[model samples]
Target: MINIVYVESSLELVPSEIIRHPSVRRNAKRKGKPPEENLLDRSLHHWAMDRLDNSEKRGRPDIIHFLLLEALGSPLNKTGELRIWIHTVQDLCIYVNPEARLPRDYNRFKSLIEQLYVDGRSPPNGDTILLELRKININQLRDSLNPDFVIGLTSRGEPSSFETLSKSLCDFNNPMVCIGAFPHGPYQKETASIMNKQINVYPEPLEAWIVNSRLIYELEKCLNVYNSQKIL
Candidate 1:
């Protein structure tokens, strides 16, 4: 099994400076856009490379990187809140059957983006399509993949990105964990109100915070339980 690390960040906020390949440079030149020169991009690139080096020493494939962007700027120092903002974005890398194909509907999402970039056409009414997809509800998603565990991340009120998956699979009674932490600027709260026993938070420098040993074991146990459940 492959371990998945989901980063909470957005695609747009990611700086292009991290791209070191000559091909990327050539492409940018062809497009007549200036080369990327962003600190975050370089930092991410270094972060990934460091992970790669560590993996190589262990005689294993490098860890896959997934960036989940929340709000662009939410530094702990700026917010003065110690919330473990779980809602935000999720970047997950999972192991799948190489021969297994993604559902056609997944490609529809990609096609919308491709049309925008390649053909300079607007996406099909996204809201209408999303509303239709939402109507499918939880059971359908459970039957589709039968994932080992469904990690749910959420912020204050509305559904965050990770909440989308958990809401979709609520039928499985997936161990829905919500961390009530929002990024800095406006939404930062004094103290997070705990609702369910399953929901918890960690200290600031949220990304660097390591999972507690006991909590890690608990998470593993939960994963096993989810895996053993009967799919609808």
Candidate 2:
């Protein structure tokens, strides 16, 4: 039920889209360096690592979100000029318990949507987007899908994640969203409990996707034949 996947930016994506991480910026400044430099820069990496080490030394939570990309020599590789796109999630992590070990190395714990994309724009000639939309419609036609709970991941509680997800909400009900390194103020207690179990504070990458797929499958089973006819 758990789906672990990897996602890489298409060649059309701009390289700068990845290097603008707050963790990278703040760390860059402490070392008397410019934050504009990419993490790939030897000087920048050393400076960022030093800053991270310093934070750990001071007992400040050093939560980081690692953006995974394809390694060099892969046949699908398309990056040219040694572009940097992995630092986009520099300082993003959830904290279910303040005293718990600050979740570091988030890169090692991310779930990718294989062959899926995050960019808003669809593929060339609008065919790819149309095809995807058709697939969703087709899936709905084949089964009943209604999710009972929904959990969301937002980098710094940004409204964009909600906005982007809302566009797809027609597929499910009002599910809960886990924002930032912390749960919402009202749902903190319940959210914390969920995080502790399946999520592992922020839902381990593998577990999170598995839960997502299960929810979808369950929703499908719950659909009524009458409702299905109406939607289709």
Candidate 3:
């Protein structure tokens, strides 16, 4: 199994900084609506009025939402061999089930994120993609997975050609890969200490979606995810 971790991700409650931004104010100013009401009128409005102070705003977790859409959707999840553990900057590690399908709908994903913010976990409705929630750090998470090999993807690491990625991971039965889900930030120190190797799949820095897609694609090929004739 090739498990992935998105560490120090920007999946936090909308900081007060952004909630009061001028752009958000302008949007809320329309019809003299409150910020939350304006942003969430058509949205799921999972955040209760009483709890808006503690509610999470969904900007950065959007990356993970897209990642889940790519990694855990449809026939890929049917393979039942992939796991994506998102370790947020707030120190909540969410394990997503490959067997459970995440909604492709943006509003649905936003609802899920809002719930994660309010409840510190997703409601277990069986179909929900969230598998587990743990109060742990990046180092502890890696140790918990205990994969035979650990690889960290970074823009500044040793260049790993795309052609060789599948072959590189194929040698290990259990390999855990990690990507920084934030736009641009320094990785936590523990992330470096926990990784067995660090590499950049692209010569230039790529967005999280591209990096994650390429890695998961190569991983699926290595696992023969869709090969009806081959057994995992």
**Relative to the true structure, how large is the alpha-carbon lDDT of every model?**
0.27, 0.26, 0.67
- For all predicted structures, in order, the TM-scores are 0.26, 0.23, 0.76
The sequence of per-residue lDDT tens digits that candidate 2 reaches over residues 32-93 is: 44444222232223344443321222111111122111211211112111111111112211
Model 1 agreement with the true structure over 1-232: per-residue lDDT tens digits: 2112222222111133335555445544654544342111222243443433222212111111111112111121123211121122222112222222222353243333233323222433442221111122132332343444534232223333323333333334323232212222222121122222222233232321122222333433433433443322
How do these models rank on TM-score, best leading? Answer: 3, 1, 2
TM-score of 2: 0.23
**After superposition, candidate 3 runs with Cα above 4 Å error:** 15-59, 74-76, 124-131, 229-232
RMSD of 3: 6.2
- Identify the superior model by TM-score, candidate 1 or candidate 2: 1
Which model is ahead, 1 or 2, in terms of lDDT?
Answer: 1
Candidate 3 TM-score, true structure as reference: 0.76
Provide the lDDT at 225 for model 2: 22
